[model samples]
Target: MSRGPVDPRLLQLSGPTRRWTAVLAVVTALRTVALVISGIIVGRTSASVITDGTGLADHRAALGVLALLVVARTALAWVEQRYSHRAAAQATEDLRVRALTVLAHRDPRTVDRAEWRTLLTEGTEGLGPYLTGYLPALMSTALATPAVLLVVWFLDAGSAIVAVVTLPLIPVFMWLVGTLTAGRTEKKLMTLGVLSDQLLDLVTGLPTLRALGRLSAPVAEVRRLSDRHRRSTVEVLRIAFLSSMVLEFLATLSIALVAVGIGFRLLDGSMTLAAGLTVLIIIPEVYNPVRQVGTRFHDARDGIVAVDRILTLLTARSDGDTTAHPGTTGEAGGRVSEERDAQDGQGGQGLTVTFDHLSATGRDGPRPRDVTGTARPGQLTVLTGPNGAGKTTALLALLGIATDGVTGTARVTAGPGTGPRLTGTELWDRTSYLPQRPVLDTADATAVGDTSGLSLGQRQRAAVHAELDRSRTTGRDLLLLDEPTAHLDTPNARTMVEALRRRAAEGATVLIASHDPLVTAAADHHIEVRP
Candidate 1:
């Protein structure tokens, strides 16, 4: 929210990153100090040899201390990298755990499972380079650049002034190039997300596509997506190249300015050899951090997108009502529950579901088109369609959850005397919809129990049994099941169909979307939806 270089929420949530970032700052500061001291010793030692007529014999202790300083700098760099990466790992783990908690409570219909999976996996992993490489570089630039500049000012005021004049140039170029580079990186991640979504959908429906002998269509689609991804990659690389060139050009010029100024002063005898050499030696330190910051800024952006995603998920919920469903209760729901309680004997008997010229269009073309059908109490309605024929879409429309584009009506009658016309979502207080897949990982909160460890047939059987028992216990007015018998054995499927028949016989409305002949043969009403 603050739009700072480091997300404040990220630091608050991840202790390791907060702790290590502080440590990295301290280590970088000490490293810069050691670097400056080494430069001074080198300059003084060289001056003693030439200007004072001295040799290595006069500077053994200084040289030894310089060697130790070099070792210290190397060790500090290692610590910086190690701690940064370690903190990154900790942050990724911490945020992912929080995201998982929120995702578990989220309504399944609101998000794409494929996309969430991608973000939690690849998106989180992308943070590695940002934390390990870019962050440390940025911290070093922030702390070391100014510190070195002040040191140069003490050693040679003229060189420091030239540096001061030229230093702002690198930042100016960085600002210009950074804006373009950031846009490029964002587009790159967006394309990657799109490609991932398409690939997951392709894999999930690959079997059906193969059965229809339409594999070539999906292959072409994949190729098209890959080309888009390639184009995005090329654009990012192009921007990266341009950014590096511009930053390099500015930094090199700034360094040259300082070096040239220092050289002139040395020749004019206005500056001592030792001070000039020291300033020259330490001047590059001023620009190196700025240069590294520009280059690594691009690297860090990939993780910025990921961090935003994680934060959004975590922000969607509070600590209460983790299992609360929108369908569970509302003013509309209270009315349905009260009516059901008063005329409890009806048990959804004599109800009617009518769709007249019903159709809905999704982001894909028409989900289902020109449908006219009815499901009455004391009868089971079965919807039959081929893969991608929009049977599921029709069910979604009935539940009043179809996204945005609505063309016609799909309504339900709640009571025997046509008491009220309600969308299934409004009547969801007494509607049981068993989707094609399990909605929640934790089954205790759902009508469909956890079937994670069960075999395919066993899973279907478990879900079907749980939903049937739940319907009977709750006296649900309508039962809508999608592929309820999928992966079910003959005996289990037969048992499930018979149970549906009994529910219809007892006066509950039953609707199913399936392709099995056994299911269709038992239906009192059958609706065929076209693609």
Candidate 2:
């Protein structure tokens, strides 16, 4: 399949960036023109002094004009640099936002946390050199190279012909080298991602590794992976340096050919000293942009690879199934009397959750299959099962969260006059699903206690309590808790169960996945998942 252009998409995402880049490109072209003009004037003035002994006073006007052009060129260059960097910064921000949004919508089960982290943080950052340096250089080349060559052609056709003949070689060599090195560059990026994932896993599991006395083996493995990554990076750099050398050689050789032709013409009186000098000045200007682009391309290759990966992730879909919605009424039994007052016009009516032959395939373990259960409005439903019985999977499937590779009929019914049926979004709007491992931020840590000094159970209790308080305050209609008591002690577990029971009594449909007898005994309803 044909792939779409990558760089333009970045520009399309940031309108201001596109405008700024256009301005920068124009300014760069004007700066190149001014530079060539100033070089030509200097060359002619020097030639005149050497050949005719012209007084410096005679060239004062030209000197003043050259100085003005120099000043203008410098100013333009400054503006170009400013706008180009601004455009690049905006483009980077747009790409990061888009990538994060796409990842946020993706099913968590289908995503690798470490890989996504690398992609979002380090991978997105790789675009800096590409956007700010390589892209602007490419634009300058497209605009300035031909314009300078045109002036050379008018001044000295022979030199211009030499330039035109050899100028194509730089890009040709670049393409040849790029084609050869593209695959390796992509492989290097993948290797870096793998290395990052391995390191993150090792760091996250450090305590467990130390407890089992198996830390040395994993540390050694990480070192081996790090060595491999280093080798791959060095290989990429080597290719980049080699490519730079080849391009430099081609550009220099081309400029030398132009210089030799100009020298011969100057000697034979076929070209005037002034025109020869002008052609000489324009020769290097014609080739410099392309050389710079060739050098910068290597730096940009990683960003190109990252763009492709992020685009692929954005285009991909989760499971190919739709979430089901069921009918409901506000007058159902166990309805909360103060629900209207608490909600204050928000939709906080309890939902009747139903599952029929629900099933899901785990990403790495056994999943619940052919499971059937229901949690009525304003009642606490507890899901109990042995390890690996897919109890958590069942809860996730019911909430339509990370349902990739999952097939099931799970529906939510809202109260009468609330709606015809509650779709996933509507249900999710009124629902809170606390996963097995709740991610606690700094604010949560501060609210709970000193995270560094707290044990696993303490942290879990803090997160659970925070969510429980949120559910009660916000009047969320549906609460899904997975292994809420997994790290809590007996007292804390009982307290959490009582908290859930109170929310159910107050008008929320609370569904929990737990192995604790305290939680199961306190539940208004219990659904067991078998292996």
How does each model score on lDDT? 0.75, 0.73
lDDT of 1 at 294: 80
Best by lDDT: 1
Top TM-score hit: 2
Name model 1 segments beyond 4 Å from true: 112-118, 313-484, 492-531
Residues 307-350, model 2: lDDT tens digits: 66765554442222222211111211112111222223346455
Candidate 2 error regions (>4 Å): 1-6, 14-20, 315-348, 362-366, 416-419, 439-462, 516-518
Global lDDT of model 1: 0.75
TM per candidate: 0.68, 0.86
